[model samples]
Target: MTIAAIIVNYGTGKLILDHLIQIREELATVPGSHLYIVDNLSPNGDAALLTEGTTGMDDVTVIGAPRNGGFSYGNNRGFDQAIADGGYDHYYLLNPDAYPRPGCLKALLAFMAEHPKAGLVGSRLEGLDGHIQSSAFRFMSLESEFASAAKLGIFNRLFASKRVARPPQDEAHKTDWVCGASMLLTAEALEKVGLMDEKYFLYFEEVDFQRAIIKAGFEIWYVPSAHAIHLVGQSTDMKDGKQSAGTAPDYWYDSRRYYFEKNHGAAFADKADRAWAWGKRAGGLKSLLKGQGLSSVDRDIAGLEAARKRAAS
Candidate 1:
């Protein structure tokens, strides 16, 4: 196979089925490409719905995972299966909520072919309102995290402005990391970087993987000509509004801290990451104490402090 498009579905049954149809109809022209869906044990019992829905498609295969392996592990399962089957040159990690425009895969493949050092290539992403998403990003550092949390960085525009400004859409640029919502990775690149770090349950795994790819002498590219429409945060939107006092924000904080620590060592990662987390926690607490929203902000800060203490010891 030339390419294996792997989608890890977690409770997004209808969307996954829809994207499979789109992939079959639009990407069928590409020779030796197949669609592989790994259902991450959705709570809605819709994994069977997705499997049955795509049964008639020639290139579609659905694997029902026995448990929810989070994003990284789920996709890695599909990647391992594809490798065992042999002949696939590239693997496309696509999110269920992301719909690719026609020729998106082809454009990415062409870019990878032309750039021998390119390990992963990501497309331009737009939301339902036609505004550009920050599909490619610099690795999230202490400063970047603050800018994002305080809504003071470039990513702030991604949420606030209806139509955000972006670099010219015609060029292929190199970036530190690309959003995993729709990314294409060469099989050779995977061999070198290994797999997506499963330590990240939901977020920041892509940053870790891309860092490994770069460290292994590969480049991460952003091809703006390819396009995909992503329904941002649809999965999170379905969850209950209440945040878990222990795990909700701790997962993010721990994952962020882990990525930095794993790549940059414990001491440096601890100082930089703890400071940022403390600052965010302080801001959240201030917001709550001022007769604002819920007091979950304190829990978030406490979680970060706890994580820092654990790392220190």
Candidate 2:
């Protein structure tokens, strides 16, 4: 019944510290729980500032990482520490920008205990306004990847069932992966999967880890009843719901290339780049006839091409 709730923090120190305060009530409802924060060597020294929130909480512990190893590395530090501490039956990974609604953590712990096969479960994420953010998903395939980047309605129709991204379902359902923002992992499953891969600087780390979890013979579920509010892009410097070139950063492209090349192979990564490039062109042509720029076609073809080439090198 004991669980470790881990948060990975970068420059978002006080933000996550405030998050710790918000979850205090939920933690009390559980049989046993502890909070672990991994400070990823924030250049601004926000790591030192975060200690104010731990004031009188004996269950809270902080790990000061020697370097910034990105999202996966930071979370893995807490994961390893929790397992070493022993007696913890579950691990909950929450984004610094996320806080569970009342009874949210309880719902995840109760569900995992009820279903021994659900190795990992994710909370249903809603924004501050209570609108469901897309978190649960089908596993990515060439079809889904191409369909998502294509910006063509036909591709979506062709690959509707295989689509990789999906919103949280109204009912609980088994899924390929859930957003890392709020995931609960069982101790047995963590023992098998080890820890989150550090190779990912930021993106796709959860997808890769969840894929490995499934391969290790465990199910992942999206639990709608476990509600959490996530203000997207708090730590990553992305906002306004626009993640275009302006928001795209170097680590993101690097992570994207690494995920595809490491998991699917270099050749497959190149194929994905070409697929999106072709899809972008097709959409551009459609826009030309309408006398307008292609709309919402946000694929960064040049950046992806560069990443694909870097992976091949």
Candidate 3:
């Protein structure tokens, strides 16, 4: 089967060049596969670097975006070009820093061929140290919003069923969504669900798209057999580690608000926002009473309130 691998480069040209060999080897497992790199007009000269590095490589194509349109925009640019070129059965969304293991592409393709209902499948992601990361997740809800922010053991246990992060799986299984870093999407699914919502500049776009996929009667799965070493947060330092509440960039809050509102409407988004606010407040009060200080989890009431105002107006 034919395949097209897409790598969206923001400021990670070196990483792409670094892992190009591994990527090529994986793609070789599927004859006639091609690679596309979409640079988001990075200010740090990534576009030129990628263009020069990929020069004379017949299997590789580098497309520069008109503007820094973020992740979804870059991927769509690659997808559009792939469509024009024609004859690709599957489209792989791969991050610049992710290195797929030997036979990774073949494994993902095997599963897709076996399960015709699965519209999207993601590879298990591991750090360089071989530690597994959270790849699959359930959709966000009121209970999940509270449990995620509260970060209390008791609340986590109580809301275990609603928690968004799914434990690492040893085998392939159905899931609500998977990380966009290493996903395999069938052309059929994209044709049905449409391209990703470009409104999300960085985050939550994958979840929103996967939600639409399921809504359109397609399944999503996580395949551990297809492994990739993901250097998480290499492109975006904002997501490197655990972030304190309210400390995220304005775009992040805007994306979060948009995801909720777009998926569940204004009333449901408001309710989820309130639930998160109260949970963060409760966590903050508990920390203060214990004299642990509020260094870790600060309440995001003000930031979220500002997001709400922007959404309303």
Candidate 4:
């Protein structure tokens, strides 16, 4: 089956070009597969650089986006082009900073082939240090919101079922959603769910898209056998693995707000927000009693408030 591999590039020009040969080689495993690189009007002139770098690569095509419309927009551009050129059997979304391990592409393809109901399958993501990242997740919920904000062991245990980040799976299994960094989407699923919601602009687009896939009577799977090394935060400059101040930009909060309001309704989203605010207060009180500072927690609250103001206006 022919596969269309789409890599959305922002300012990661040199990084993506570095992995081009390896990505192309991985695609070669499946005959007739081609690579489409969508440059999202990178401020550093990455579009031109990517174009010149892939000059002689017959299987690679670079699409320069007229404006930088974020991740979903860039991938949709590649998807639209793929549909126009020739509909592909499958569409693979890979981050510009992510490199799939050997056999990753084939493994995902095999899983999809065996499970006709799986609309999307994602590979286990690894860090440069070889640690497994949280690739699978449950959908967001009120319990998860409180548990995450509380950051306490008791809350996590109390709301274990609703925890957003699922533990690393030992084998292929169904999940609510998988990381977008290295997901393979069936053309059938795309035909059913359509392109990702461009309103997201960045984060939560994959979660929204996968949620739609599930609602449309399809399954989402996590295949640990298929692996990819993802340089998390390289594309967005937001380090998620650490607890740091100012790591989350305004768009993150905007996307979070949109995801909740669009999927769960305004009242439910408001309740979720209140649950998180209460949890944060509880967590901060505990930290203060322990002689620890609440700088990070306070910053998070302020950021959310600012985002709310922007949305209201």
Candidate 5:
């Protein structure tokens, strides 16, 4: 099978270069695969340096995008070129911060061969410490959004099916979407669904993309046997440790709003905001009533309100 890997870089320095190196090392024996490092108009000189440094490597190319058009734009550029070049049967969207283990690409390729209907397959992502990251997920919904944000045990148990993050199962299974950190996409599936929606500046593009693919009658799967080490948030710095996220940047909120609005319509997106507000309040009330915690576990109420407002408008 012929495969192409697209890595989007934005001021991530040697991390992107190192990722390219590791990908080359792992895929040395795997044939018909090309690697692209797309520099997304990073402000620093990293773009020039990255382009200069990696171009000499076999089958490696650096693309300098004119604008700093977020992750989707960069990946879309790579995908476009891959399509024009032809002979590529699949496109692997690997994050700059992620490193695949030996045989990772081969495993994904083999799985696609076995499952002809598989639209997208993602590797089981392990952090540097070997703990499983939340790679596979359910698509977002009103209840699941509330359940995740409320962080209430009751809600988690009640909404487990709708929950966005799925724990890696012992066996392979189907899921609504997989994280873009190390995603594999068949050329046919991509051609059917089109490319990643560039509306999302950072987050939720993968969910939106998968929705379109599944709507096109393709299946999304999680393969635990194929693995990659995601140094979580090294590219974006959105994460700090296991469970805690640093204060989210503004684009994150905009992307969240855009995802809901684009997929569910503006009116339903408003309802989602209301649902989230009510969910937070309900969870806090339940916690207070049970004496399990404080009056309110939703400490980021202001942030949520602002985010919802942003989405609503």
Candidate 6:
């Protein structure tokens, strides 16, 4: 089966180039493959460099979007193009900052081939140092949302939460959702589930897409044999430097509320939203009581409340 690899890029030229080089070497063993890079109007001129560098590869195609479409819309444009172009049985959605191991794609594709019911399969993700990262998760319900808001879900166990929670870890195990960093989806699955919801902008888009895929009767699988190293937060850190105020929190919180409201009900969304707001208020109050000063927690709480109100309405 033909496979098309799609990378949605927004700056980080060096990382993207490195990822493509590694992918090219890996693709040599897996023939009838194509690579497409979609650049979302990065200000650093990385798009031009990517377009020029990847032009030499016969299977590579590059498209530059007019503006930043976030992950969903930007990746969707290339995905739709690849699907229309035909000859591809699967589409690999990869982040610019993620680099697949030598046999990662082959392993994932083999798993997909064996499991026809799995529309989406994600690899075990590790950091640069090879430490495990949480790439698969259960669907977020009110209880799960509350636990996370309270930082009591798995933060206590930290990296071992996946093991402690006993999240499916096998050659092929079903999951509610997998991280979008390096997910492979069958073309048929794409046709059935439609494209990623652009309204998500950044966070929670994968969760929303996986929800739709499951609703459409497709299973999401986590393949432990395949692996990829993801430089998580690359885009977010680039957008708002490491030390800057948390400018991207609103997008995340809003998207979370949107997903909860759309899938569950307003009550679930309301409870999660209130919990998040209360968490922020308590944090801010604790800071004041300790003479540490508020760190914009009040403003964050107000924003989350506004988002909750909008979602409820």
- Give the best candidate by lDDT: 4
Q: On residues 106-195, what C-alpha lDDT tens digit does candidate 2 reach at each position?
A: 899878878889999999999988899988998667777676666688989888898877855788889999988999998888889888
Each candidate structure's TM-score, on Cα atoms with residue i matched to residue i, is 0.86, 0.91, 0.95, 0.95, 0.89, 0.87
For the record, the alpha-carbon RMSD of candidate 4 to the native fold, in angstroms, is 1.7
Give the winner by TM-score: 2 or 4: 4
By TM-score, how accurate is candidate 1?
0.86
Off by over 4 Å in 4: 241-245, 290-293
- TM-score computed on alpha carbons, candidate 4: 0.95
Residue lDDT tens for model 3, 1-313: 8899999998899989999989988888888999999999989999999999888988999998999998889999999999999848999999887889888888999999999999999999999899999899999889999878787898999999999989998989999999988999999999998788898898888999999999989999999999999998777765622343327666677788999999889999999899988888777888888888775455367778888899899
Which candidate do you rate higher for TM-score, 2 or 5?
2
Give one digit per residue, the lDDT tens place, for model 4 in 1-313. 9899999998899999888878988999999999999999999999999999999888999999999999999999999999998889999999987988889999999999899999999999999899999999999899888888888899999999999999997899999999999999999999999998999888899999999999999999999999999998787777752324444677887888788889988778778778877788878888899999988788777766776677678
Worst 10 residues of 5 by lDDT: 240-249
For candidate 6, the lDDT comes to 0.77
- Assess candidate 3 and give its lDDT: 0.88
Q: Candidates' lDDT values, in order?
A: 0.76, 0.82, 0.88, 0.90, 0.81, 0.77
The C-alpha stretches of model 6 lying farther than 4 A from their native spots are 152-171, 238-244, 281-291, 309-313
Overlapping backbone residue pairs in candidate 3 total 0
Angstrom error at residue 116, model 3: 0.5
User: By lDDT, is 1 or 5 better?
Assistant: 5
TM-score of 3: 0.95
